[model samples]
Target: MTSPRKVRRVVSLVPSLTEAVAVGAPGLLVGATDWCVHPAGLDVVRIGGTKNPDVAAIAALRPDLVIANEEENRAPDLAALRAAGLDVMVTEVRSLDQAFAELERVLLAGCGLTAPPRWLDDARAAWAAPPSAPYPPRTAVVPVWRRPWMVLGSDTFAGDLLARLGVRNVYADHPERYPRVPVAELRASGADLVVLPDEPYRFTADDGPEAFPGLPAALVDGRFLTWYGPSLAGAPAALRAALRRAGPVPSPRRP
Candidate 1:
């Protein structure tokens, strides 16, 4: 049974959410998943990975709340947590707007914070206006994985972020959120660039860029591209730096 009093303890299963709570209320989290890598020196009990958390260990922590993401966590796992009498807060963030709203919901309501965090405000401000330097509109193919080769499709937070950066995803109209496409199809997508992030599959400068030799591959921080947390504050500048380094951005400013 969940306590009606103040939430004194928390266990986060989502990496982004763990960072958000860890930053908002230090020491509030007694337990977090192995993937919760933000707030650098976070010292907490490691439950397990996002997809495969140790439910027994998490319950043993006796947390006031357990945070999870709809996309990153499985339904049965969430169900198991709830069945174990844990107060689970599952979040869904498919766009930048949703991120801010969900963050507020999770931090203020779920964790019982008095108000919103400064980083949330800073993140909002960072994306308040599109950058002054606008490149000619470009299209991109964002591969989250290789081998089987899954890419971001429609209604995704990262795709929305890229769109805000003025880069349209070629697969934005696909029916599935994350779809698998053949390497040949991805190569022939005619996108101006390939935006690759360094998580889910760890695409690096050497590893990912070689896949799309014909297109300029921008190896980006997956945390910035995907995670909606403290990293969001500097994502615009960080991503801009990476994207600018990619061939298509500019040799000289339009000014």
Candidate 2:
């Protein structure tokens, strides 16, 4: 009888999972995708991007386990890895609650941690729902991309995070998880605020705010709004601060 192989060396395809495992187990993560930027100064062999990882390179690393997300990773890649005889752990987190449960599973069951990581407990406490002080009501147009104009539509981790921050996504029932809506339609969607995050599309104060003429734009951190790792501990407070900065700036008085 052979015992199961331990997760000694891990490769994380999801940026959030990378940070979780890297911080929790330290040195267990040997490889990660190029996009795994958290815990800055993370020293590991860069395999490639999430959607298109270097399979050959990853196979060469001989990882005991590879962490990925249902959204960030592609099915074909997971299949190829499995075909190569490597164990792949995929996570799916559409809401705040699911994120917590999945994080615990990834850290303990997937990575073989003896107990729940401290960050998980701290994150749970940080986002313990029902609010300490009720924030003002807000209806927001949360755009994650531009040029093509994509928004946070139904059942997304970002949308759930925003909901907890006292902001309701205008397109929460758009049918598509991330629907491509026309800019003009978005402007007329009766959203009082535009919540833009600096990732998947870097929306700066100048770059994104101008699109919504009169709407207050809350430029929040994408990591805080999207990633479900150690950053979850600081996300609520950071997002609250960003939302407070929401206000429309008049366009330079038209020279």
Top of the candidates by lDDT: 1
Deviation (Å) of 97 in candidate 2: 0.8
TM-score list, all predictions: 0.94, 0.93
Candidate 2 local accuracy as lDDT?
Answer: 0.89
What local distance difference test score does each model get? 0.89, 0.89
Clashing pairs in 1: none
Model 1 worst lDDT window (10 residues)? 246-255
Model 2: how far is 42 from its true place, Å?
1.1
Best model number under TM-score: 1
- Estimate, for each residue in 1-255, the C-alpha lDDT of model 2 and write its tens digit: 444347789999999999999899898999999998878999999999999999989999999999999999999999999999999999999999999999988888888787788989999999985563224668889999999999999999999988877788999998999999999999999888899999989999889889998888888889999999999999988988887777433233365
- Cα lDDT tens digits, model 1, 1-255, are 444348999999999999999998787899998988888989999998989999999999999999899999999999999999999999999999999999999988888777789999999999996574236766899999998999999999999999888888999999999999998999888788899999989999888888887688888999999999989999998988878778664243267
The segments of candidate 2 whose C-alpha lies over 4 angstroms from its true place after superposition are 1-5, 129-135, 247-255
Off by over 4 Å in 1: 1-5, 249-255
